[model samples]
Target: MSTPADPGQAEPQFILYLDGEAYEEELRLLATWVHALLLPVYAREVTSAEPWCPRWWEHQEAIARLHGLWLAWQELTDPAAGPSGPALWHRDHLGAVMHELRSPSGPFAGCKQGSHRPKAVPVVEAF
Candidate 1:
């Protein structure tokens, strides 16, 4: 059996689980990475089918998915992850997240190049 990690050293929570200032701060950082690095390096031509929202943060699904990708990136790109860290990140995390977010039926489906169309939340009956 293995010992539990110390509470003080617990891993960071996912962004979707965070609220208030924590969410805002993390989202800001994520946006920086998405714009400065991810978009510049990998963004393909925008099209109707494979759509991309200019305001992706508006989409809860996008935020959750991207936040997970960013967390993986942080860990996998670290020097401690070894020489293949970056390559592993690309193979495992980056491609899947990007594809899902940009797929024709993905989160940004109705969004256009310069427009952001908010998706309606499905209503649920209260218990």
Candidate 2:
């Protein structure tokens, strides 16, 4: 467990790690960042070879992956992170996440430009 610097302040929650309202709020904030900064700057042409889901939020894998990317973006783009921070973010975080999210066999595998396909979850036997 971690303590907040201010007694009344709540501990920050990571997006995928949150539940209920906290998850919803974080998703909204993440959507704003995704729309305002991430997509405008980094969105590439969507193609069959590199698929993208119109409703990425519906995909659990995408939510988890994007949340991680967004967290890294927040940390690495801060002024206190220094001059090479953005470069490091680009090299270390951007490429891998984007590739994973956009690859043909990714979460959006069967999705088209304006369509969102929900991926099926694998079944596991309970012990």
Candidate 3:
């Protein structure tokens, strides 16, 4: 068995884990809300001077923080070796969605092409 890590280490391991999970959850929620709730609304309004937008910048910073937290967690979890945490996070979150969308055509796909197929619906658009 591997020796346990030092709790007094600079990294709060649990915080890293939580941040990474939150990042993925938030991303999935955003994707779900956009795809399931939003509607395509066309508006004919164009001006050279859009209002001074600080919110967009704020959101970008938030996303960057999430990314940083995830990477930091990954580094802590496995120093020289790669951890499956991030990969599993992606597979459990985004990969599942994509898998539902893409059809498994390979014969050895383990099952005879299940009869269930999810609806291919485009639910969100932004101008």
How high is the CA lDDT of each candidate model?
0.86, 0.84, 0.35
Angstrom error of the Cα, residue 31, model 1: value is 0.7
Report the Cα lDDT for residue 25, model 3: 68
Which residue window of length 10 is worst by lDDT in model 2?
1-10
Q: Pick the candidate with the highest TM-score.
A: 2
Candidate 1 local lDDT, 38-126, one digit each (tens): 88999999998679999999999999998888888877776777899899999999999999999998999989999999987779999
TM-score of each: 0.87, 0.88, 0.22
Better by TM-score, candidate 3 or 2: 2
lDDT of 2 by residue, 8-126 (tens): 75655667678998788889988888888988899999999999888999998898888888878777776777899899999999999999999999999989999987897789999
Off by over 4 Å in 3: 1-6, 10-57, 64-83, 93-127
In candidate 1, list every pair of residues with a backbone clash.
none
Off by over 4 Å in 2: 1-11
Per-residue lDDT of model 3, residues 18-45, tens digit only? 4466646655544343334321221112
How many Å off is the CA of 26 in candidate 3?
A: 19
Task: Give residue 33's lDDT in candidate 1 (0 to 100).
Answer: 86
* lDDT computed for candidate 2: 0.84
Query: Relative to the unseen true structure, what is the C-alpha lDDT of residue 45 in candidate 3, on a scale of 0 to 100?
Result: 28
